[model samples]
Target: MSDSHPKVLLTGATGFVGGRLLPALLEAGLSTRCLVRSAERFRKPGTGGPGFETVEGDLLDPGSLARALEGMDAAFYLVHSMGGRSISRYRDYIDRDIRAAENFVRAADAAGVKRIIYLGGLGETGDNLSDHLSSRQMVGEILQSGRVQTTALRAANIIGAGGAPFEMLRYLVERIPLMVCPRWIDTKCQPIAIQNVIEYLLGCLLQPAAAGLTLDIGGPDIITYRDLMLIYARARGLKRVIVTVPVLTPKLSSYWINLITPVPAGVVMPLVEGLKNEVICKDNRILDLVPIRLIPMEEAVCMALAEISEGPGRIPSMQSCLIRDV
Candidate 1:
């Protein structure tokens, strides 16, 4: 609202999206503070450069949240409880996420935080949604219902190195020559690049018109899980045969993914459950408000591969990958 840059407080600074978003936020010249569980864990000697600092806190603690949000112009609600390594503990993720969001809403509202930006899943809201996707949407609702202005950016599977969806796809195609898939393989989803997601999040903060709105963000291509598998296969110069089986439920599919990928079953199960439902963007208003060059699936997969690859095996880009043809 003023000529001076707003002070921003970022939660989940050590998370998948937050980890990446932190650098982008600092580089864009905002005075940034990270609300991390441990300052020592999220900070380094020169990590975030100028106008960056860290505050130790937890979302579940209202006092800590108050301390973190005080004097901050904007904050990001990026915390999610689904990434734990213990499979047995995943059952509590939904409840914990709900509580955390409630705390954040109250704390932010009381502290007079000007705006909040939440990154949520891109699934249709209804009674039949998976627990993971529903929890994400519920958190958005919790934040939006508060007195503080909130911008919710919903996106489907984000393609990037070390991300759950990308890791599952990468390891699956790299290891499995013949995959026994379920009916959800054909489910439609609009995937977005991690970089694109970062840009949209940054754009929302700068564009005040984005306040108190829910926006769908996705890449240029909308494809099925089967199409993504095929694209990953092509990118790596490998041949894969996927045979669909109607009876292989989400549990079975998650088990299969757990055995194949480095990602834990705790994380894969909820994501696998979400695959049964279509997750394409409902609208593209964000494209007009925060215009960005969307990265297609082909290029996104290649970019992910390049990140995890070593010196001799890197696929520089989609067009330059020698095996992208077949």
Candidate 2:
């Protein structure tokens, strides 16, 4: 670690979590460079944020990645492929995600980047793991396999405005009075608020104890997906009738969700499958390393609703057109 402020690189800076994290890094007085395919999307020509700059790069492009990573102390790997626009494109997400991770690892190692912090999906690892969960875990493993000190923070269903899960719940609950859901609604999940997620991420950057560790971070409440929807319904002051049917498979659920919510069937595939497993935190080491009062699920939903009052979700036009991995 450097004695002075560390220079960090942020990937997926325009996505849900990355967008929120960039400003936080800048506010903390760290020189943060965002890696983007198009720099113009991050800032207008000849204008930039204090302590922040955008580098034209892609994880899949090794030459560009090396340039973006050069002289960086640490980096955040927040990039994720949301299946794709159509079913055919969705088929290659696992391979695409893996290749990108491999490219990143090689680039970071060659660049001599000391630390890599990654936000990965939370789920049990085994033969039963969903394609989404397995791919996420594989990406984390890929980052850790490199020479750098990697901190992998696994989280389930991050609840906040503009997030895919929140957006799905927002549209589904707001639109349908009678919601028909699969039986997996009873699956337990420990979801953290976006603010808490950012704090934990910053903690991993500042505190060396978090390096080379895989940790789980979640909220104070460990509840079922059904409870999550009820909480949202209650917060919105709307009464929803949730019907759970055993016959509905994950594929069917995804399609139904796609039909009703902004989240597309492709995006919902992994999400609904992820819900089939219990995603509650297995340990709280991250809290011990970087302590904060975890927000309650009800409060988290209320806060998300407050942002909705500000207007529609702030996803880019393309991202909004389909459901995304939260």
The lDDT leader among the candidates is 1
Per-model TM values vs. the true structure: 0.92, 0.93
Tens digits of per-residue lDDT for model 1, 171-210: 7888889999999999999999988999999999999889
Q: TM-score for model 2?
A: 0.93
Clash list (residue pairs), candidate 1? none
Which 10 successive residues of model 2 have the least lDDT summed? Answer: 317-326
| Candidate 1 off by > 4 Å | 43-47, 310-326
